[model samples]
Target: MPKITELRGLFKPFTKPLHRQWKYVWQEKGKFNEPKLTLPKALNGRQLNIIDPLHDPDPNALPDESTPWTSPTRHPMFEYLVPPLPREQHPLFHHDQPVFLFDSKTKLHAGVDQACLLTKAIPFYELPQSIKQNLDKISIPNQDDLIQSYIRQSIAYDATKEHLPRKSTPLKQHRSFRIEYGIPRSRQMSILFENILHLCESLGGRYPDLFKRHLYRNTPFYTTYERYGEPIHLRNKNSYVLTSHTPLSPIVKRLNKLEISSGEKNDEKLSTHDPDGHYLMKGNDYQFLNMYPVYPTIDLQPEELYQDGDELGWRQRKTNEYVHTTFYVSNDELIHESTTDERLARMVMFAFGSALVQARQQYPNGNLIKPVTVQSVFLLDELFHFVVFQLNTLNYNETNDNRYNYVWIDKDNYMYDNRPSMVMHNPVYGTERNLQRYVLEKLKYNPDVFQKFLALYLQGIQGKKE
Candidate 1:
């Protein structure tokens, strides 16, 4: 029990005195849990003293100003100088490494609404009709056999999955624990990618040189973008898998080759004259989405502005400079949920951002350089979202630069549906028959999707450039 003085010191600054707390009743147990009937309900039609009557000549009739909550401010008998409540520090105030390590740092992840805004790209939802028509032309050697083998591997991976450390902590924060169910998301992703890569490798004899490219894990691809006079930086420290080398050919021809009128901009063409959806409030950009900064945005001084494109430890001499494909796996993490539309947004932004970085590395001075292209594959839930971005132009100029990047998004792709396993593995649900309960049947396998994946992979392998 706290001392009366201590209790008062703690809560009195923020709370009101008993008399000042009008209309609030502390009914005694003597009342046997029944609420005290003060007066007839004012809004009730049958109440005799109800205020619905037309006459208002009762001059001496005083109002119930003394009732609870009658005054906005406290109705204390004597006013005294009340000190404001003491402010407390964050839970992890003493944490050696804070969430944002540097001063006034903003971590902008690739997201849906800001994808077009960040990349300054023209979005062609789904693969273009031309790409679709060309899909049947690019045939993978022994694709059916490969897919079956791939499916087998995928199932095996799924059936064999076992939880390692089933629970973990937040990023650098202590004491707070997070419980993860089933196989870890990272392991599930790894298994999925491993299966895909293994399947891809099975064709090494036929396309030997195409398999020469390397795959990197948990790589960081940090880049900066300026939006609405604010420099937003994205330090993608957890890019699941980034396949480098193997140049990609754009589905459409380069912007410089095509003769587009100087009077027209791609964004404007997409937006028309209407200010809707994305353009609903231009001055209010991402802020208008109702998703603000996780913590209060740190106000920085003028001196804190950075030199922007500082590629971390990625040297120019590295042979595998061109980013071929990036694999991202998203789930219901504490930070962001992998919703359908949001996943597409992430894929587009990730593709464009990676391409921009690659472009900057190759053409430092903004001289004559071929466009950089990046393909992003995002896996959320069981669905796969594919995005291909061709970064045609970047900041040698202003916001509405005529030369815009081209992006194609196809998010309605799932490799294979989950299935009930006789191979009895991890418990996916309750204590019994978890596998049968959770996994979806594998009957809904889509061969065309993986074919498209292979097509995207092999597009420019035939016509490789330096």
Candidate 2:
């Protein structure tokens, strides 16, 4: 070799070291030795007793000579409370079956009964034959045209100086005409319009004139432009657009807030790199800015309402001021195992939990003046579970207090077990009929609740005018 250093330099330029590719390989095949864990049984085999002895009397506990009495000062709505179904009457109660009540057939019927009663005011009937014959002629675009014509009437009225104007053309001829109309640009509005069109089609199949009348008189549409504001596109940042067709004031107000934020924030960049982007500062950064004065407001914390214990398995913040509903759907295992009660309880938690979150969003200021109603529905394949809860107090912060009450009707097993193919053809009209019957039954037992719901339902359907 010329020199060791020279040889090394030559080898470094041409030679490559052989390296082995390594991968994680078990010396012995891995085994999943850990046992699969089963879900813990609800209440650890303890009996579930939801009855309040102080409020609800036990017929069995009465002495032989004791006479039954009713409260004179009982609230008007107290009569509407559904009495607990007997164990013998419960569908899931069998000597061999697990003692659970929630997802049982009885509970499902109770939920459905309550839901049906809650919105009993909504009309659901088969359309007349004359409308059905001409259904093929109706189209979404045509409906849009009709709605546009109705909107033009408002525009035309606004343009006139009143005294010299001729009688406005009758907008009722248009099948899509509504007392209140809004621009249909958003995905939600589009979906709503689609559903309206479907409803029109369904009703048109039977009574075209009635369908037209309902669309024009009963349904309300929110537009991007109205007499109260400019076209949504040209409106300034502070302008609020009415987006919902529902008459529920609270829901409408919430929708307005959404529209305002959407309009103002649409063009604003969210990234810190943008010149006009806003950032949340903390500690010293926030202190240095010395922002606008903050006012004191009630902070409604929904999370504080939840309690977990062995007694009832789970508890949630409930207010007697609002109606609360629970729904449950059992899985195959639960259904096979006859664990309806546990299923029902789980469903109630889910349904109520979701409603609670929505309520917080809808009433962010925490000044809900009207009673809040909660309807919970649980579906297990073909089985339907429903419950209605009324919250009498908004003070959900008091976790220890039993401030809410509920009614359930789960004895009847209303099945919507139509196959997907059959649904496309027939579309399960049985549920509507069943709901109607439930409403009729409630009307007989408690017409006041039905009337109260009707007023609220009508108010929601006929949304407030500007």
Candidate 3:
């Protein structure tokens, strides 16, 4: 008993404060649990006022004549000040990164609005009639209007599938990841050339002359050797094996040709994988409509934690919820020396953005809802900045033979140095080095500016930044 008393004495100070806190908590909880009397029923159809209305002067009354159109700035209570903006500076800060603002009164930066306006400069139906007609002729009625339809008809499709639905292109649906040779070796190059010519003629007959001119004249022949810096033999081979030492030009070229062929014909054969050396083997046809495309597997909602005597005091996340779907594309589609993974990632982003726009329009209350744009890029370097650099990097000098040197050249005359030669040769080596350094440095550090540049490119003439 004497030892117990000593221990109690030692704990008295801590116990006193803790007891007080418990009492306070209980008092609050007691009131919460107790029932309050309901207000007396209104008598004689009159509303009851709990407050003295005369003293309050009807608190909801509008401001009097002294108020100004805009509220005057009040002096800060704390001894701190906001930095003033420069006279020439725009209102936005770090415009490229995503930002969240909860204030209802605040508006989106004018530049964002301008960006949206730019997309409208080009209409959905502005494509050439040949490409357009081929789409209608080959693709399902719904997808005929898409850019993918034209690409499919021009590049991937064959003559047989005229009325088929877009049951997933080989680009998206090939189950086994194996490389397959298309057409016999004797007529491989010949077939590609003929296909290109045929597509051009078909496009020319159905589309406007302006479009035909671009398609036939500007578009390169459907040879893998002419696109990526790989040999013609590398086409339809597993990229991992070939790209280990070979440049990507040939593989990229071949896949591009295949894509165009499929697009033009809308044939199911375009999506087939090689089975027993038969590249065009008929495979299990899985319908996109039948497939239940699932959203990303993530629990977007935050877990709730309950305290002893309180409702949630705060939420951890404002909007972490998102939906994502995975679609496959042929690694073959993205072959070639010029085909950086970064560029491919950018392509994926663009496709998703376009799809998001369509989805927003289709959903209920979409106009009023501002959805967050979230995407994962497939290629490592194909961020917005990398995409811009690539677009600007295209050689505009069509007359220069070496300009297309980045493409794969024929190996038939390997002894003759038949490979593509460097276009930027210099009599003085120092000048060439300096120029390369300047361009390389610019791309490395200041890529955000280039991203802005490409964003502007996506805009039409009416889309010039104000």
Candidate 4:
């Protein structure tokens, strides 16, 4: 590994220009208008198994004669919760509750203006197998230009790798997949309800409606499930079909009537997925406004809206203030010790003010909107969350006085700290980071991946940094 000083020196010069270039290129090409080049689906073409439960023995269930063993347990009520109840709960409800607390949905109401957290896995699975197989061979507009441009970048990075000690490699930064769904127009609003009806028809009962009603009733609320797959299973599983006599909401019932043709029990054309097995068919439906895929591109710094005096330090202050407000500071003692509603009021003001300053510094002639400028403020929360994770991973929880264990003082009187442990410890986090790193290493050595790291870090900061 390179020395910290040497790495810093090597990285410092490239930060500003690279930041400008990344912002420009990413913002320009990240929009829906940017034609997504198609690639062949990988898993879509497989001979997916959709076994009938009646035809085969229960795969998910444990054999009745199986012995049960106990393991060490943890949790507040573990001592009282009794041991080794049964072997039936094989698929244990071991959910990451902490992960759900900082879910993407929470950020929607926060100041994260127009963000997209498109899971590559979901899109990759949704495409047809035939289409995915031919992805590499597909000829799409602007695709070649982008690839060529990246290739040239890679060649340059390869030539200079030794001096720079490149931390990231070049890889295809942009990917797109195609989706095709032919849902009838009338049934568009009630897709969930209609899907339940199909389940009932297939299984010869009115059962699918229970899950639909449950989900519908809990819409726009914080809900939890043992598994994300449970919803899919409830909709697709053939055996042990769930039934409910629950009546649908007026809107759903009307929409269902409109969608079904006279005496037509099924709308086969619009549906996609294995009839014999359960696997989610993922894609954006262009035909439906609510369900359409939002291929979004966000402008981090709108050049048209810029103001002066915005520097790195100012940006930090602005970001801090935004985080303080967005997170409910319910602790009365913390607020009472301070003389001013100053802390709360200062939060939004400083964030917006600094954002304006930062934007103006980048675009001297641009017009800055105070509200939109606060978008950068959203990034600060994610940053703080990372800091907490770093501290926690280092066994330095802030709730205790040992927080100092995670901090180090630099010669410049600056505090140098470890990148948060949050990204390192979580399996999902590790997976994403590893995939990104893999892609980076594959690409020609460049700062683009680091920039992506920073962006995602900012995103995490906004949602979870608090």
Candidate 5:
């Protein structure tokens, strides 16, 4: 006969917990804090079996004796709060165009404009002579000439590496382009709502009726789901189905309606994840409007060359590179700030560049059904500079371009001290019309570049209507 210890070893596998049961216990108590309860022992030197009463076969019992354990169905307590009808179909609900809002709180630290005129400037030529020379050397296809011309005009590289002395070696070139720019990850939506409120108020003062009809304070949520072909038993083993939410825009609804009306096959089913969109703008404080869009760019580190064996000269080696895509506007007023005409020019260029890229993405394959408009607001401490650009054409074939028009409103001097001016006003319940008239008069009397821009903007608006 086998010893008692050997018999216990023979039945050890049956007495031990199954992998699934062990996992459940571990999940409940955590790996480090497992329970100290004694495990089941073998029965009579054989595998022990404890039949559950619910699953046991009883001849006299009903057919429901083998019912598995299941969690009780739960109903949300707030189910009564959900409205019977959809909010969008409600008579009181308002739906309007979505507005993109950007805010920056960077303070003008050092007056670089007063110190050195050339230090902070980014020089560019409309038709740079270097572009012609570059074109002469490189046989660029006719299709690519326009883009090459734009690049030549926009970028200038230092040739110090090419003319280095014999003893001094140059670093390897590692240029990178940023996919997206502005607003750091940590502070992306930090002041978004605050800035939206200010923008609404400012525009509302000048165009009350337009604001009421066109501006939307909220957007609906959109959700998408994906499913995998798996058996029902293995559905929970891995995530067989996944669900996610996407940002909703008013344009999406308009597109969907157009698709349905045109009898086009729509692949996407549009529905809101939330009953109502998030409230973006609230409160009366308008100080957050004085924010700027930080340009996205990559920083290149100095390249290091290694001399592998004396036979070969110094060769460039690959190195790890760090890239930053998100940069948020800061509200710290004590930071030193510098500004120059060149810096401002570069900022404008980047603003237009990014806007153009976004426009191209939206209206891909040369689709010009609707014009693209980008509004950029630059906040320099207390100063505010608003720029509006309307892209009428997006053909890259034309080397010399005249398809876009822009208006820049620089309210630096008048609104510098934060006084009650034409642009800056106290919030009044019923005095919007009076404020509009006051702003229009101020625009007429102002002997600045903004006055001419405003006139042009009004002309464009009127022309569009006609």
Candidate 6:
């Protein structure tokens, strides 16, 4: 045989063509090759009765009494294993204790501040002026033009992905026949936020890393606390909850944070009282003027079996315990048309703040280690309800001058006035029905509203370097 030489590829040209060169080069087995394969053994210590090939089986049934057995075993390990009994018991219903219900299915209470009273939050009408000034100061590249582009692009994605507003089913009700149908609010909201984040990355280029470390979605969390010696709980899930490695710097002034005068904590009707008046605010008292004759806890249904976890969207880790913001897009479960924007904003701040306080692993009736600031936005269709909550203490029973928590809300922000509509003669209704109908034409965005949203998103992260 010719001397073997080092080669690089499979199809190298040979000087003299022959069968021997082909055999050594292609078919020769070396150290890397394994021995011939062995068939797997049969189960239950009995070999499978295969006459020849896998497809060849005994066509005629052999009687079990006449069949010959090679071997049998009485070993205990060969028998099927039985499952062990459960150590803990699980119940179907909450029989022992009733937990106050604050889930999505809960209806709107008569008073706007019901959730506030339960969570021990003080409500402010507008956002802090310092935040507004900071918003105005934030700069963007060609923001006016980019805002409109983003608005159009987001709507395009929503329309292309989802079915258009066309007549599908025959409805008997007149109110149900809508010629101008708005796209699904939740879907559109996600598209818009994604586009905005992309824009922020293009301009500022730090949001991607921030979101990687902070943002999480669909993580279930709940805060358990007591109200008037009764157990209460609130769960927050299926929303975008952004957290940070460290707590947000306190927003309220040092003096105001130290103590909120009972006068400040009291309602407007009580506002007329002397500025220096000494008012004693009770833990269970309804601070606002009541529309409902009963207590704020009127409709809270309870559960004996409540989730004991106080996670802020992740497992107990060394990072991202502090919640920075929660973007609540309208889910039909949590938001309804009957509830006003103002009330919804208040409810979100209370529920989210309670979650943060619990995440800190602090006692519900005691002071928090530090202030937990949470900024939130509630987007329903086009309206944007912005809220900022600073939870200082969960000690509602404190008789001292300590301030509990603060919530700042700006409820009057809209992305656009109306979507441009065009008349279309749709044939789905047939010739009998009037041809008068309107279809979505295009989207015209607002610059100021988008700026406000961007400002809120970039609030605490502006000072960070690349």
Residue 171 shift from truth in candidate 2, angstroms: 71
Sort the predicted structures by lDDT, highest score first: 6, 1, 2, 5, 4, 3
Per-candidate Cα lDDT values, in order, are 0.53, 0.29, 0.24, 0.25, 0.27, 0.57
Off by over 4 Å in 2: 1-334, 397-412, 416-460, 463-466
In angstroms, how far off is 94's CA in candidate 3?
A: 8.1
TM-score of each: 0.55, 0.24, 0.18, 0.14, 0.26, 0.64
Clashes of 2: 53
The residue-by-residue lDDT of candidate 6 on 1-466, one tens digit each, is: 5335535432347653666656656664333454553456644466555343434457653347666543255356744443322323444345566677676556545434766666667666677655777677766878777666666555542444443344333243333335544444466667777676566555445444355445778777676667667777776664777666555666653423233334445554433452211122322232654535666667677566666645566776755366667776666423333467435634554445444655356445454556667788776656677887777665666567456566677876777665422222234533211211111243445677777777776666634446
Q: List where candidate 5 sits over 4 angstroms from the true fold.
A: 1-336, 367-371, 395-411, 418-466
Please identify which of the two predictions, 4 or 5, would achieve the higher TM-score against the true structure: 5
| Model 3, runs deviating above 4 Å | 1-89, 94-339, 362-418, 421-466
Q: Global lDDT for candidate 4?
A: 0.25
Model 2 poorest 10 in a row by lDDT: 231-240
Q: What C-alpha lDDT, on a 0 to 100 scale, does residue 264 get in candidate 5?
A: 38
Model 6 — TM-score against the truth? 0.64
Top candidate, metric TM-score: 6
Candidate that scores best on lDDT: 6
By summed lDDT, the worst window of 10 consecutive residues in model 5 runs over: 231-240
lDDT per residue (tens digit) for residues 1-466 in model 2: 4878544433333344422111111223335565554435775576544334435567665555666554565465775554544666664344442211111222222332232222121111222122233344433445444443332322222232322111122343333212322221122223323343343344334333222222221111111111111111110111111111221222111111112222334434432343212211110122111112521111111111111211111222342122222223232322334445544433343333333333444476755444343444444433444433322333433445322322232322333222121111123423222332333333222122222222221222221223
In model 5, how large is the Cα lDDT of residue 202?
Answer: 47
The list of candidate 6 runs beyond 4 A from truth reads: 1-95, 157-161, 164-184, 202-212, 255-287, 290-293, 333-336, 341-351, 362-366, 420-444, 462-466
Superposed by TM-score, candidate 3 places the C-alpha of residue 437 at a distance from the truth, in angstroms, of 28
Q: Give me the runs in candidate 1 sitting further than 4 Å from their true place.
A: 1-113, 128-134, 138-185, 238-246, 254-308, 312-320, 331-336, 396-400, 418-433, 436-442, 463-466
